[model samples]
Target chain A: MKSNEPSFYEEVRVNGISRSDFLKFCTTMAAFMGLEASGVGQIVKALESKPRLPVIWFHFQECTCCSESFIRASHPIVASIVLDKISLDYQETLMAASGVQAEEAYKTVMQKFPGEYIVMVEGSIPTENEAYCCIGGRSALQILEEAVANCKAVVAWGNCASAGCVQAARPNPTGAQPVHKVISGKPVINVQGCPPIADVMAGVVVHLLTFDRIPQLDELGRPKAFYSRRVHDTCYRRANFDAGLFVESFDDEGAKRGYCLYKMGCKGPVTYNSCGIIKWNDGISYPIQSGHPCIGCSEAGFWDNGPFYQHLPSIAGFGIETTADKIGLGLGIATAVGVAGHAIVTNVRKHKEITNTPETVAEPETKKV
Target chain B: MRSRTNPMREVHVWELPVRLYHWVNALCITGLCITGYIIGNPPALMNGTEAYFNYWFGTIRFIHFLSAFLFFFNFLFRIYWGFAGNEFAKWTNFIPLKRSQWKEIMDVIKVDILQVTHKKIDSIGHNSLASVIYFITFLIFLLQCLTGFGMYSAMSNSFLPKLFAWIVPLLGGDIHARQLHHILMWAFILFAIVHVYLVFYHDYIERRGITSSMIGGWKFIEEDVYERHETESKEKAEK
Candidate 1:
């Protein structure tokens, strides 16, 4: 508590990350924040003076993969500083604290640093009589509401906390709700994704410590710095999208070649967030990069989008036939006829039903008729 | 120019070109609505499944596109006419900066709701009051084109669709673009219904057969009304 990470920083040695690598990591983070090159100095000052903010990350009603993903931030130094050395105050998922003591650590931090603490809530709140989800005999929603009430600002860890992920889907019996819904009168920056890339989470925290406030949020209350552009806008398979080449199946050659997944229910066209750019596994690969269609995990309600493997009804304006490329030329012939046939048969049937009264069975010609 | 033809003086009620364009847009838009609705969910065939009836779509689409093309070109002419046509067709003719128009718009609303006539100027070439309605029609037509072509853009070889991709962003996404397209079609339909009713209301109540001016190209302005064409006398006003 009394300033000692510096001496620890001096003694600590990762397998290969040089001092230069750590500084380079900080500078990269500063840049992601849209900070001036000079802002790197502020990051250095905070890292030197603050002894790493004590982050008490709470996980409930989530996959816990957000924590798993954060520690694996590709860059050894980023993972080292934020996950290893960042003096995690108490994490329900990975902390040494147990029972009341574990819960007490978070309470202590809230009381000691009312205006300066960070509350990162991962997963949605269950409101159904609190029976759906209970942590330590209390509802997760009650815990979240209390924690958020005292903190400076809240960071909704992933799509679960931000947009009420799968648990909040249609007919969500748990009554799961996102953090933003319960915590009003507070700044809640939603870092949306199924389990967002580790660096993106670190980047948000770095910006918070450096800027002393949350980064700019778009209309969805998501950080504009991250969720601004769409995945399709920057996807490597974009050329294939334009050229109309697409993967028809998981085992198909087009999939092996990594063509666009538009036909495969990739929600990239409608979804706006960073995935194609800040890919997972240290920018090594993302879902799209790994030859899997993007299920749009970063968006609000991806789970209810049905099975990830099955493509949706063709996004009308976007092409529908993702896996139907076997008889590519025939698709045009087939769909065109389908369109024409649908309209004509419909109209003709309507016309005939109105006019084709059988002469014998039809009402006898009345004087009124 | 009240001495010539004051808007407040209620001279010529509707100008030829502007009025004609308004009515034509209304009629075509109504046609677009009825046909579009039928196209979206066609009637069941009385004939067996194999019986072909493909031309209905072709015919409706052709009618829609042709009418749309006429409306769009008519818009182009109006834009040019806004600069080069007669005094009423000029850009000044389309302005509505009158303090009373805004003040009376509420009165217009009240009167409309109560089925009473509010104090309003008889305008020629769109009254300061009616000009706002025309401008609204103008804006809707533009939106209809953008939305219409955006729907058509999903097809293979349409030019307007390619040129106007901005509609996708306005819709927040393509996943529900058809839903949006369908919704906007109904909007234009509602607009046309109100538009026709208003035109008829003005014609019948105001004693101005303004609906025919679009077809006939001349309003039967009352004599001594100082209709911008001061050349016409009472004797000629009747003629």
Candidate 2:
């Protein structure tokens, strides 16, 4: 720890936040991380003693939704204390420094806190061309490589950094790839979502700060605390899905009844996220709650999964006949027609042979007689 | 000079275990395909009933999963029977390791496909080409199991289905794995169609009672053909 740097507790105290509110913030973060009551104490102790963790947030081929979501953490303590207390050394979107000055600050942070700082990447990197995304005349790839070179751990902020979001969808013109693909040898915590829940982002930071290591991640590198279950599993309307009652269309009677959106092409069955448990925009409502089906923004390659309004995707290489059932029906009809033709040929051949056999037999019999 | 007429003789071809496995497998596949298709494209049955009043969709998924387990077990049993059953049902028939087996495939293709010849294939069991196709079908069955159970793991809390969880990520995600699984269901349906047609065709042309053989566990082969097969088996055993 640096001798002169103030700890997170001191920063909170200096910012006019009461000790009780700061403790409450810790408790909320612990609960969001799916931790037991004991976890709150650990977070408190870590925040009080440890020096503020240095973070460098980078932006590349992204929409800055992650930054927007982060500032709107809902809990006032999170936006005011936790985020402010974190010694955020360099953030392109949030920081006031720009041009040569911003580049200088980024470089200074890398040198001053080498191997001690955290790197939170907010978007994907374009490997197809360096010109696709650049800042300060440096390519995104170059800046990302430099930022992640000596970081303690890398946090891939949203779906863009986790799974290459829309920019990396089918026919990707930029050849954009996720953060994990570009960086290696460091623990990359993928916070998956088009724009991950603000609390989830705070919860991840809390987990890292409290445990001094990355949380348990699933096979796709998403935190297990939030990504362990599918959105459908925890949905409030799951009973409706099981009941076979579904909203047929946006303006239908079923839509007014708030039925399950499964038939409306909800990707909740496949998407893994905490949207159902922690609703968006301060737990007010999620996509399904507001009469919109989940687009599966958290999942990888969701853009290519198919149309948002259709449940089943058309099979990719099947030309005009896209759906699996359509192709199957076509194949079935072709086989039936082929079989009938074969059967007709077999019968014709048999009839000719039977007719010819009697003539040959009569000729042999006459010769013998 | 050969005999003027060759008498047909009954050969015990399909063992009891083989016959049971066949019927059970057929039933399981039918159940799985029907339930699986419904899961993929569920019909919208809108009723004013409360959510708790309807458990039909849940039951349909349960049936799909139940048939999947049965299908998986039936497939495993057939693989075991391939080793334990008669020479005609042996694993050797499915794998074209021998030059004679390859030649048999070419010969059958000539007769069945090219239609250049009307000569009959002399095997008393499944023809060589059909065995190869079955082998491929078995591979597809394995893929179906991995993907089906892989998706099931997300909904299930048991240890068995969780074992196949790795397949979901390996195939890209839940949706891709599901897409592959659904496409292969159609493969099974197509295989069934061709298989049934060939069985009927072979029964009519050869008068071998091929269709009834699966049920009765016997095939009627010409005496000379059966004798030749016996001699060939003995020679192979000796070698």
Candidate 3:
């Protein structure tokens, strides 16, 4: 696949994209990466000179939603140029080669590229048993470790590969783990979402190709350009949250009035993502804009955070979904009852003590020696 | 029947600063609990006016944060006073170092929990067992402050709350820190109920003005108990 390939700029030109259109793509990529206008020229120069980056995308215990999101990206250049430009050596879902031929291509890329290729992980790796999710007689964990041994960087594609999503939720039977937990020593960039926004995925790739470095990341290893602010911080309905106008239920008047969904269990306040700003489907609308609350899918252990419709999560340790109100009210009632019973006994005991004591004659007040 | 008199001596226990801290902290805890509850589970207020005019939730959060500051500063004052104030308020009194203090603690448990009314254990300051409980409560108070400030750090541009931003990540995340903060409020509420009940119960049994001591800083001790306290203080001073 890598034999005699032209550079990204040449490939785009061959695909009928004009030089001006390619420059516009570079500017959009720079802006998406939160870079200054000067970065656009640098991106153009990099794409014009450097060959396409060789990427080996791996699939594990996942639904392939990340690949679906990436292919369905709204930009024409994203689908036609960037995806095609990257010499994606081996992807089980997207590539035409399979069986011995696919394995041969993967080995060839690993040998030829060595430390230059990027390893993109699309889902969590199940370590409990190799049979849980195996590809070509090898476990996901084994393949992931082998794939990233000498790669330049690792990109965790979505929540599954970054935070172990639903497969690693409470009572996880497969013992699934995220990519970073499995591979160390390499720079692991997490594009975290249930399925991260398509444009965001494209932007990360563009930034990596142009700068020849991983984008600046937050404490969670997510690209800071996309995850720096929480959903609540930039929400259009934030004014309603501050004003205390909350939707009591899904079909109430507050819902019709476009009140905040906080009371209906919106996780926007705790979730960090670019959905509120970048939006989805070519900046059409996001989930919150469509009147549904954020489920905090980008966060760690979101599946175990509790029901999506409840406002506050139940106390975590209790086996059932027991709320703070139930516990507090129960304890308060018990204490009141105990106090009332104890008061009765104390009064009775005091009455008995008073009755048992005999009267004595009082002496004139005098100072003790 | 012959009549006799038992003379009692009055001793000052709590200082002005300590008493002031006690009441102000009580008020702050009450305010914090109420406002924190509202913040966590906000009610759906009827929308009659413009959204700008309806700042009830904002006001609730402001009150919670204000009470948090008062709670934090009052706790700091108490810690300082434990080092600089009277013997009863000193840090040494809280630590169960002496054999006598340990014995008094057991005796207090026997009388209070076991309901053995015949035992008469007397001390001018806080009982050893009560001091230990207060010490633990102080630690919980510090935890509440840390988690509270950690949650505020994200919203606040101020320097003080920002100092605790590390706590959120350390405790797993903001939601975990919030759970801890909320649970500790219940701990304080439970402590208050037991504390007030025991204070009144001891006042009835000991007749030492236990409840009133916090108000006027005076405790009525028997003559024998006063002599013993005087000799102990003199020995401490000599040492």
Candidate 4:
């Protein structure tokens, strides 16, 4: 079955891209993967000869943003070549077939490819009830288990699939679980972001196609190349952050001067992503560059961390979401009042005791120990 | 109640290392709390000066990280001193393991919290309740060091900070670790307030020269108190 599949080079040529363009794409992919120039030839050879890998893309409880991001990739070839070459047999958003035809195609791909295919899960799997998110007739959890049962590896495409995004935020209504939690014993490569950078998505696929294995992952199971450095480390506004020049509000003078948005609750320091470096829309701009503080959409439980406009979450134990300042100040004031009251009470009691007591006779001095 | 005017006998309690650790730890915690608060909620210092000239925030962070190191090492010194120093500073004294220690803890609580001052405190060093509280604070200090270094691991390339990098992920990521670290600062602040107040309170009531003992290492105890401590040590040695 695999022998009948056309290689990436053949597919690209048939799709109207020239040999030079394909080689250039390979080189670019190699660089994005953090491979040296010497690895470019290896990528070229692999793509030129290796059969296109079968992929079954699953969408669970999501907004279809990952699919939108993938389709709108800045590089035209990413859609025209990489997407074309992937033999994407099952993606609800992108696949043309629907109803029985789509279900048939999914079944055929699973049966024929078995362990040879890769599973690309784009959203979190809902476990609350089967009725919450269903495809064809099966729940997302049921569908994911069947699809990932024999896949070579699973690539969790975005924050939803990687860390459950907003759907799995605090008080998660759907009991949404990321792919890693649902699937076990398989390498789950997380390309995390609200809608992860398009090139990053393509790069992970390219690495899989070329290397025939999962990429190195960080502790959070994200690709190390893109997720290792914090967004703050590579942010253009880092100098401003270090210098303590911050935008006080959305329309402040500091905002106009391109100051750091940390005071306005930019979570770049804690969030790890390639946004500051690789950037979005082909390196045009990112959240910080566009005068918006990062919402920390990439990190786990980002939604519950705090408000996007505030620096820190008001700890929950207080009656409402209150900042440390309010709580600390209140405690300090209360303590001061208590101390004053206690001092007054002690003074009065001491005065009464002193007046009641008579002068005591001096005792003989004991020998020093 | 016998005479109330007996001359006090001075006994050296805190050693040189203990006194040094106390003041240095106090200074380091103060520095950490101030700079840590700024780091968490930075002020919008929008001075018209060039970004290069205004490195005040960077200086604040530098001082925070520096004091963190000092605090960590100072704590380690205290831990070592607990093992090697005199009986007053020994690990056994802080553990609150014995039945007598528990009694002392209750007695101290009665005097301090319940406002019942009938029972007398006989120990020359830290009372049982204070020692237990300090032990708990030491545990908190260790946690602070772990989470602080874990957050620093991302920014720093040093091997020491790198060792703590796992703490972030293990504690459910950087944001949670930071939150825990930030909240613990308040614990220290509350501890400091109560600790200082209680020290002065005990000094006034017992007249053992509590505050100055931290500086001079000598605590003035009544003759009976000194004899009791001496006899207790002699009994323990014989046992």
lDDT of 1 at A364: 20
**Residue A185 lDDT, candidate 2, scale 0-100:** 96
* TM-score of structure candidate 3: 0.90
Considering chain A alone, report the TM-score of candidate 4 relative to the true chain A.
Answer: 0.92
Quote the TM-score that chain A achieves in each candidate: 0.79, 0.92, 0.90, 0.92
Ranking by lDDT: 2, 4, 3, 1
Residue A9 of model 4: what lDDT? Answer: 81
Error of 2 at B112 (Å): 2.0
Question: What value does the lDDT take at residue A77 in candidate 3?
Answer: 82
Q: In model 2, what is the error at residue B167, expressed in angstroms?
A: 0.6
Q: Residue by residue across B25-77, what tens digits does model 3's lDDT show? A: 98998999888888888877756445677878888888988999999999999
Error at B226, model 3, angstroms: 2.8
Query: Model 1: per-residue lDDT, tens digit, B55-97?
Result: 4444666677677677777777788778877666666544567
- Over A236-321, each residue of candidate 3 has an lDDT whose tens digit, in order, gives 98988889888888888888888889888898887888888888888898888999999888887878776777665786686566
lDDT of every model, 2 decimals: 0.65, 0.85, 0.82, 0.83
- Considering the two chains of model 4, state its CAPRI-style docking category: acceptable
Runs in model 2 deviating more than 4 A are A81-87, A319-321, A350-369, B1-6
Please say which candidate is ahead in DockQ: 2 or 3: 2
Residue pairs with colliding backbones in model 4 are A314-A322
As for candidate 2, its clashing pairs are none
**Interface RMSD for all numbered candidates:** 19.9, 6.5, 7.1, 6.6
